[model samples]
Target chain A: MIILIIIGMSLVTMIPRVIPAFVIEKMQFRPWVNRWLSAIPYAALGALIFPGILSVNPDKSQIGLLGGIVAVILAYIGLNVVLVVIGAIITVYFLSL
Target chain B: MTDKAEIYSSTAVHMIKRGFITGIPIMLGYLPVAITYGVLAKQAGMTLMELTLMSVMVFAGASQFMGVNMIAVGTGTLEIIIATFVLNFRHFIMSLSFMNQLRELKLKWKIPLSLGLTDESFAVSSINKDEAKMEKGAFFYGTIISIAYLSWIIGSFLGGVLGDVIPDRLSQSMGIALYAMFIGLLIPSIKKEKKIAVIALFAMLIHALCIQLGMSTGWAIVAGTIIGGMSGIYLLKEDVA
Candidate 1:
């Protein structure tokens, strides 16, 4: 069962990725669809990042927000992803102290 | 061999080598996180072999973490399968976009490329695609993904061996880094386009509201993305135009 579940997981993840490249190589999405697709990067990033921020238990009120803000600032200046994350973690740690 | 053929082969080889080296930083980032995943799976009563196989087969961080939870609670296999499938459904969108970008690449490359299409790898691969005049070929992406794959496997082994070496405080704090990484990814695009900021803000608001109202994470994200993207089509169109 475990192995089957693993295989099933692999199929679901892989099929979506695999089918498009091979099967739909010549197809182009409609303009509206393309618009929606372009919006995906931002929308998806926002959804993933925002709620998780609030869920982190706060020491002071909404303390994690500071980390989020710091991360955004660091990232904006073209800092590497690793550094951006480390900066946010360090900021939050200091705020906790 | 003809000079043309030799040059082509060397370029391909060079791209692959460059890809592997570029992947090193992503490998570093993934190592600790995959190790964290390993630690979680271990806590959930996974045997070392089972955990190793799970990471190998799944190769997805969010799903693996959730799969460990489901397994720990003795959830049905279907539930585990369904939940992971749902969590990973966004891969459909990502793959579609990525595939279109690779019009120059061959159909045969799809298999391995798809398997390696994690969020981080996708981002890195796309950047390579954009920066080059020539196509970032199958072997280049394969090399990039393989480095990440190898690092993940090594990280899991270390985690299983170390067995919760991270202190409690540090562990909880590490959670913030995931959000931080997401923010880092978005900031570049947001800097490039004002419209993206609106979409991002709306998506965040909608997803948080959905979660507060007790919807599931996967569905909430899907809903938020759709709504936010739709809003962009209507609301930000004027600004963009």
Candidate 2:
């Protein structure tokens, strides 16, 4: 049963990812559609970070928020991406203590 | 002929090395999150094989986390698969945009490249300005994806092996690392084009609203991305079109 579940999950997950590469290159989208598609990465990044971060530590959401804030500051200061993540982790670690 | 061959191989090697260097940040970001996923999946009663296989096969962080959570609660197989699909639907959009961005590459490379199109790689690739100019652009991109993929597998395997040995507080804290990476990636873009900030804000608002209404996290992210992306049609300047 578990093996079946894993296989099913892999199929569904890979299908969406794999199909677009082969199909979309042949077609051309309208200008506005192109613009919308280009905007997706930014939007997805936003959606991925919020609400989910707060709930990272459901019992102490502040830890996550503070860590996010530190990340923003570090990134705004033009720190390296690895350093930004490490900075947030350190903040969360101390806060959780 | 020998000189040309030597030059070609050296360029490929250089691009591959550069790709590995560029992927270091993503590898760092994925490590903690992947480890956390491993630990939680173990606690959720997944055997080590099941836990590792899921990461190896799915290769998606958020969906994998959700899959394990759902499995732990004994969710039906169909439900888990559907949820995984919904959560991962963004990859479809990202893949299209990514392929379009790198349309100059050969079709053969694009197919394999799409398999590694996670959020982290997509962001890095999109932001990278020099890919088109490189002699082996597709290979460079492929190397970036390969390093991230390898790190995820290694981190998850390590997490499973070191599950109980690691303290609880540390693993919980590592949860913030991925979010931080996202912010780090998004901010530079936001700084360049203020309109991107609006798009991001719109996504955050919609995602929060969906969660407040008790929608699943997978659907919420999809809703937020689509709706937020739609807002760009109006808010984005004509220059972008």
Error of 2 at B63 (Å): 2.2
TM-score of 1: 0.85
Interface RMSD of each: 3.0, 1.6
Model 2, residue B96: distance off in Å is: 1.8
- Predicted model with the maximum DockQ: 2
Where does model 2 exceed 4 Å of error?
A: B237-241
Per-residue lDDT over A1-97 for candidate 2, one digit per residue giving the tens place of the 0 to 100 score: 8788889889888888888788776888877887887788888898989988998789988888999999999999999888998899899998888
Write candidate 2's Cα lDDT for B129-214 as tens digits. 46755678887899999988999998888888887555778777877877888898899988889999999999999999999999
Candidate 2 clash pair list:
none
What TM-score does chain B of candidate 2 reach?
Answer: 0.88
Please report, in order, the local distance difference test score of every candidate based on alpha carbons.
0.74, 0.85
Clash list (residue pairs), candidate 1: none
